[model samples]
Target: MIAKQVNQKAWFMVLPVFLVVAVSAIIPLMTVVNYSVQDTFGNNQFFWVGMDWFRDLLASDRFHDAFLRQISFSAIILAIEIPLGIAIALAMPKKGWGVPVCLISMALPLLIPWNVVGTIWQIFGRVDIGLLGHTLAAMGIDYNYTQDPVAAWITIIIMDVWHWTSLVVLLCYAGLCSIPDAYYQAAKIDGASRISVFRYIQLPKMQRVLLIAVLLRFMDSFMIYTEPFVITGGGPGNSTTFMSIDLVKMAIGQFDLGPAAAMSLIYFLVILLLSWVFFTVMSNIGEESSNGGS
Candidate 1:
């Protein structure tokens, strides 16, 4: 019998990616860590703050308020987008010219820059010159996002939905398309209703992708800044201020480097924790499904 040799050359193919990540990701992370631990007071002067900034942030009411706002926004976005995306995907045809057209149309909003989306909506919602605002105002609706908290929240949420629902739709559509025809054929043979088929077959098949969509939307909505910043400027008494906006104000606007960096790290860790929970739950579901299938 001939001795077998293990091939180790494949690591070379991955070396470039490791190097790129270290340069692009790791180095910046270390810098942020350094900033988080030190206080700077102009003229490049620095003093060790240790965990004082973290303690202050934890005690701050502003931090709590911002976190709550972020959570609410993310929850609202996920609730609206996930079902809407699924419904749109389900309504889409599986084939034909319409498929590409529909995909292209759905993808258009996502392709627009975040700031541009905010600007478009900001202008579009103007009560005087813009079509939507003018029409609503003409109908006697008191719609002013700048002064009204509810209106500001509604505008920001609606803008986010319009811009990001396409991502969920695309992911769900891909999952839907991946299902083999055999499953549908079996459902048809069994005289199953469309609802029954969806609940029993389609939903389970798309669970993994749906989990991903939910997690991504949650994180994105939680950290949302640019759109809301441009549209509402975190105004109407900070009703629309999320964590990222607050962090920006702290770091750039106030030049509180230590506190801002600490907040940023906390924000990042929260996202990481949530993502990990989502992944673990989804993995368990997948495992349960596999075992049940067997």
Candidate 2:
């Protein structure tokens, strides 16, 4: 057989995308890196500070508390959203007009602007005017998010779930759709229960997409800002102040650019590291699944 000539034309096709990404992403990243290492007093004034800001951030109790709160929020969000999404997806019709209707409805929340979501929820949770808050108050519950830390936390968590669970649902639903009917047929032929079919066939097949869902949710939740900020304003004694909010407060509120930049870099790294871990674990799981299939 004659050796086929390798196509060089594909490189030309990809070049524009590379150039666009470099300009939009890499240049801004370099700016952040520069800011992370330097001090700026005012217009055009700068001095090198090395790792001072990093050390200070690491030692600060405020930073530690924010970190812990962020981690906890992310964990809770993942725990609630992933399972709930899966359940909703499973319960949805396998085929019909209902499928598109369900998908479109689910996607509606995601289509809303982030700031708009925050504003809507902020008004929605007001005890006097909001349906939820008014109903809760009428039911004799003390449900003032403005004064109660627990209430604020609960509201924020619930709001996040309402806003983002749709994403998880969509991803899981797509994964479910991609699964071949032959597997389900075989499971049915063997008299497998619903649970057994889900466990042995569905769950395994959806692992890769679920991994993507988990990573996306984790990163988004961890870096969340606008919703909580608008609703709680990091209030109720900073009980709802996540790392992203704190970073914004430092960078803009305090005008501490150097430290803020350092913290931001660290924050970016933490996200990158966690994403890497998720990717590695998913890759291993995929490898094992492939080996087993073979």
Candidate 3:
């Protein structure tokens, strides 16, 4: 018997992407690592500072507050959007001309540029001239995001939901559409209630897509910068100043490169860790569902 030799040329085809990633991601990451432990005074002079920046960041009240704010914001939106997305998906027309219309409407929000969404909302939320703000004020509600911290948070959170919930809806809709008709027929023949069908069938099928949507939204919301930056400018006195905003303030606004680099590394690690945990939990649930179904 002759053994066939494996071709090694596939790696050569992948080489370009590897090099591109190294240049774009790895190089900058190493540069940040270099800056994380060094101090700079004018004239490009640098001195080693070891882990002092990381220690300070861990001990800083501002950092802790920003982190808590970021976590809270992510939690609030995830709580709202996941169920909201699932509901929207379930309510959508599954097979009709209306499906395309509904999908297009959902896609429209996602197509808007992030900065444009922020600008549009910023203008749309002004109590003097903006529609939402003006209407609320005319109704005798004191809704001033600019001068009010709670109002500022509310505005930002709403803007994020409007811009991003569509993504979840689209994902869940795709997951729902992929469900086979035979399962529905079986459920109908068995006289299963709508709630039972959903709980036992639809929810299990949607687990994977929801997992993807959750992970994506978690990372996006956690690292959010542009939308809130343009909308609230992180304010009504740091009420909405998230981790990313604070990191930018340290790195660019204050020129604290060492601390900023350390914070960024920590931020990256946190997202990585959390995403892995989400993926693992969802995977285990999926496996258990499959096993139980079997």
Top TM-score prediction, candidate number: 3
Give per-residue CA lDDT, model 1, range 1-294, as digits (tens): 987769989889999999999999889888889989999997888899899999999999999999999988888998999999999999999999999999999999989999999999999998878788889999999999989999999999888999999999999999999999999999999999999988878888888899899888988888899999999999988898889999999999999988998999999999999889988998789778867867
Taking all chains together, each candidate's TM-score versus the true structure is 0.94, 0.94, 0.96
For 1-294, candidate 2 gives per-residue lDDT tens digits of 998879778889999999999999888888888887889987978899998888898999999999999999999999999999999999988899999999999999999988899999899999999988999999999999999999999999999999999999999999999999998899889999999988878888789889999999999999999999999999999899999999999989988888898888889899999999999998799879878977
Local distance difference test values of all predictions, in order: 0.92, 0.92, 0.95
Off by over 4 Å in 1: 1-9
Candidate 1: what lDDT?
A: 0.92
lDDT of 3 by residue, 39-123 (tens): 8764778799999999999999999999999999999999999999999999999987999999999999999999999999999
**The best candidate in terms of lDDT:** 3
Return the lDDT, model 3, position 270: 91
Give per-residue lDDT, candidate 3, residue 117. Answer: 97
Pull out the clashing pairs in model 1.
none
What lDDT score is found at residue 101 in candidate 1? 99
